[model samples]
Target: MKLISGGRRVAGNDESTTPRTTGTKEGTPSFALPRGVTLLFAIAGGTAVANVYFAQPLLVTLGRDFAISPATLGAVVTLTQLGYGLGLFFIVPLGDLVDRRRLIVMQLLLLAAALTVVGTATIAALLLAGMAAVGLLAVVTQTLVAFAASLAPPAQRGRVVGLVTSGVVTGILLARTVSGLLADLAGWRSVYLTSVALTCALALALHHVLPPRDTAAPSMNYGQLLRSTLTLFAQERLLRLRALLALLIFAAFSTLWSCVALPLSAPPLSLSHTAIGAFGLVGAAGALAATAAGRLNDRGLSQRTTGIGLALLVASWLPLTFARQSLWALAVGVIVLDLAVQAVHVTNQSLIYTLRPDAGSRLIGGYMVFYSLGSALGAIASTALYAVAGWGAVCALGAAISCLALLLWAGTRRRTPASAAAD
Candidate 1:
């Protein structure tokens, strides 16, 4: 499959990432998306993405229920992330090849079924299988993002993407809090059951509300479609740089989230699940604050947004370094980290979508591959590091990753062709 550039197919050797300069002709329409549609997209994307994270706060409960050892409990999250990573490569690319609306609805329905398996599981094997299934179907979140990007006019794509991604970040950050509350009120199983009901409702609503659009059938087979996703990175320098930044940022993000409960639950504080979960609310506030990042990209200030956001990411660790002693400090660190991460994330998506409007799904799906990998790396590395050293070591690792991202952004911003930024 040929990559689309400026509404035309570019050969494999072409290095041009920017679409041709048609000025207002290529970047026209400037339509106002209904507030209701954008809200629905946000809610749907948030709910779908939340499925992968609901397990984080419930790992302790799950370990006891399944009689699993504390040392191996991390496998629960590992399996889910693995499934999600595989889905990003295999299932997300299908958005470009098929009816995205139907595809999204189908994934939701399957996701509901997967949640049912999880909520009803009586054995360890069943629970792991269900979690894996849930993760696989959760790629619907990315599909919703690509669909929203494709629906919006070029001028408004960044704003729409920002709004939808804010929903995604909200889901990811708040899932722990909500799951903690649900687990405290009922049990861990209730968390999955509740999500099952929510997923089904979202599927029906999306099917009804999502407007039917004519999508041309791709000429290439499914294998070629998957290959095209990778081909994009080789072709687009912007995608490559942005994806690497995604890896570093999310690694920093996962570092904080994956092991935070440990220090909170240990002897010094011994906070309850609900108390630790409340930290999510602090992170959610930061995520919402970053919704404006899309507008900044729309204003052609992506470089500034990225530089500032990455610096904030690095600075966030300073407060986190004091988390072992102070709750207030932990809250401040979480907010800064989440805000900076979301801002850079929104900027990354907005910038990449401009490179290939015709291949929206492929671009986002490809970009998110790095996101999954980074999350997995951070999750594993943080836990191991925390065990060997302590919370201080974990914070140091996160700071190092954040600093690497900032340096990479600085180096690339200087070398990126001016024409690419104008797009």
Candidate 2:
């Protein structure tokens, strides 16, 4: 029950919040995981993130049958964001308290049930409610991230988070692709069914591969977790900066996806749903940026990595202006955009996870609250702008958000110390 030097915490001590008595080898590869572990990560990340976008590609079809206005149909997305934000505040913090694998399994089961309801809901209100439930359980991604951090060696923390986060990035990118294909082949309902299948499979896979819990960190009730999350938000300036950065970036991100399909699937191009999904494949290049950042983070270049990622964010917006000219330009933009977001996100997490290792789950929850808010605002604004002003407005809005995010980063860069920056 002692605090380590240089602000590092050993677990089980009141003064220091890092989990202790976890019996970890400082430099060992606890990441010597089985195939089941990888499968669980892919499935868990895919299913959780997919909940955010399942309805995006399917909204038009839902509108055709349900007779809801586009604004209301948009609630299918908005309600989900609200629910996800709530879950990030309430559920994600539990990872540091309870056993992560068990929590993940339980949430996966709940998500499966929610997806089932979404697949079968016939009314707009019912569908919205189902989407909310789906999002509530979708915070399972936070648990997976915490679990990965807990298993990683300190030296490789960045790489481990980056690797797992790469899975999450893939999920975010592929959700649209998967939904497009499923919506085209079967029905919009089939998208939910696909998530259900993945959720069930991952629940089983994680049960086998995840390690046992560490007894050092004390488990708390939900109320205690909430207090911890709030305390983190109140105490950590870096958390504020990172959260603000996330909001701006995600706003740009949601705005792009919200409006991109409108142009691609309309007027000049008239792309099919499957074709739009194929476009998502271009974002897979982001995995490289994420991996490179991980290596750089270990090499004490987190600040440089974050700065580069932010620069890429600003640079990525230029190609969208050329959508009227070429598809390749849009593809490159998507890759750069995803790469930038993932790199900054992983670097931010590597810095924050060590801030309060005992509260990893709650810290993530607090950060994601702002993330969800940005997403909702972006999606709403993007669609509304596209409604009146066309693709130019949507693309311009996205670029503006990215520019603002960069501004925020620049404003904060000089003030932070070398350790947090390198971390």
Candidate 3:
């Protein structure tokens, strides 16, 4: 049997062929992934990614408990994002070179241990260390996404990736809500404890259910693998373009969510943590855009979707500007912002996966480096900007970032025939 990937025909019994080999020898065995398995991937991806965000809503309670100022507590979020970015560049590439199921299981176990440390930490340093470890191990989310892309057929890959990515977005949004409610019921430590339990359960479930891959592993060493990610960035034009877009848009996203709780906790609104967390549920409505974005990408409308998504992203900030006074405006902006971000994200992934099917993990890892950087920038900038100039400044910053992303898209459209056609 043979399969086509990245415009080349590779000899393989199924879709899971090694990246180096264009064709497999005779009698290699490969099997189709069932829909149940895909759903499991989605659930696992969501569960894993949720670990990175569980602390966002708990920062206030955590600050109070540790006697840390809000400004200093912002370091917690920034350091975690820094760890995640490091993991994206250094750890995620290993997915292409190892047995991904085993890698996934090991990472999840580590994640559980890290969560335990976080839940029990007495010192601020201990807690921050644990948070960084959690962020690092949370790259399991990307590994699972690559695994899903590898297992899916070409025609349906966009849809499968979209659904799994939707799980990721859902986890992110819901983590805030779940953490807030849990922290309200118990203490902030309880949030980490709950994550420990969930991570352990999911780890065990994945070990039992994830399909075995019979494909040959890549021959590259760890250093070589890491270097190749940079090489990939240089070689793939679409990858670079999409990654930059991800950076700008996610920066805008981080700017909004990173400081949203601040205003909600102050002034006329004076919402409880629980009430602020409930906004995640509102934002989740936007995640529904993931599936629709996937369908558009499948129809070759990724560039068109990017333009629209960026425009919507900029528009979302308008409503958010009034968030200090009007919760309704904030809610509307959250929904639109999440929808815009997820739509662009799904489209980006769909396009990148098509670029190099065999190297899906590396490609995704490289692309997500931009995501982590953008998120970190947003986390740091939002808190600082909010402190200096207030929510209006944050909104202005977000709107500016969104416009930059739109401009990048427009410039790309001018240079690339496919992008121009999409316009």
lDDT against the true structure, per candidate, is 0.84, 0.77, 0.83
TM-score of each: 0.91, 0.90, 0.92
lDDT of 3 by residue, 78-138 (tens): 8888889988888888988988888999999998999898899998899999989988999
TM-score of 1: 0.91
Q: Would you list the clashing residue pairs of candidate 3?
A: 11-23, 11-24
Off-target runs (Cα >4 Å) in candidate 1 are: 1-31, 419-423
Which residue pairs clash within candidate 2?
11-18, 11-19, 11-20
- Cα error, residue 295 of model 3, in Å, equals 1.2
**How many residue pairs clash (N, CA or C atoms closer than 3 angstroms) in each of the candidate models, in the order given?**
0, 3, 2
Q: In model 2, what is the error at residue 190, expressed in angstroms?
A: 1.2
Over 216-271, each residue of candidate 1 has an lDDT whose tens digit, in order, gives 57899999999899899999999999999998999999899988987887888988
| Model 1 clash number | 0
- In angstroms, give how far residue 188 of model 1 lies from its true place: 0.6
* Candidate maximizing lDDT: 1
- State model 3's lDDT: 0.83
Which window of 10 residues has the lowest lDDT sum in candidate 1?
Answer: 1-10
Error of 1 at 140 (Å): 0.3
Q: Which 10 consecutive positions of candidate 2 have the poorest summed lDDT? A: 1-10
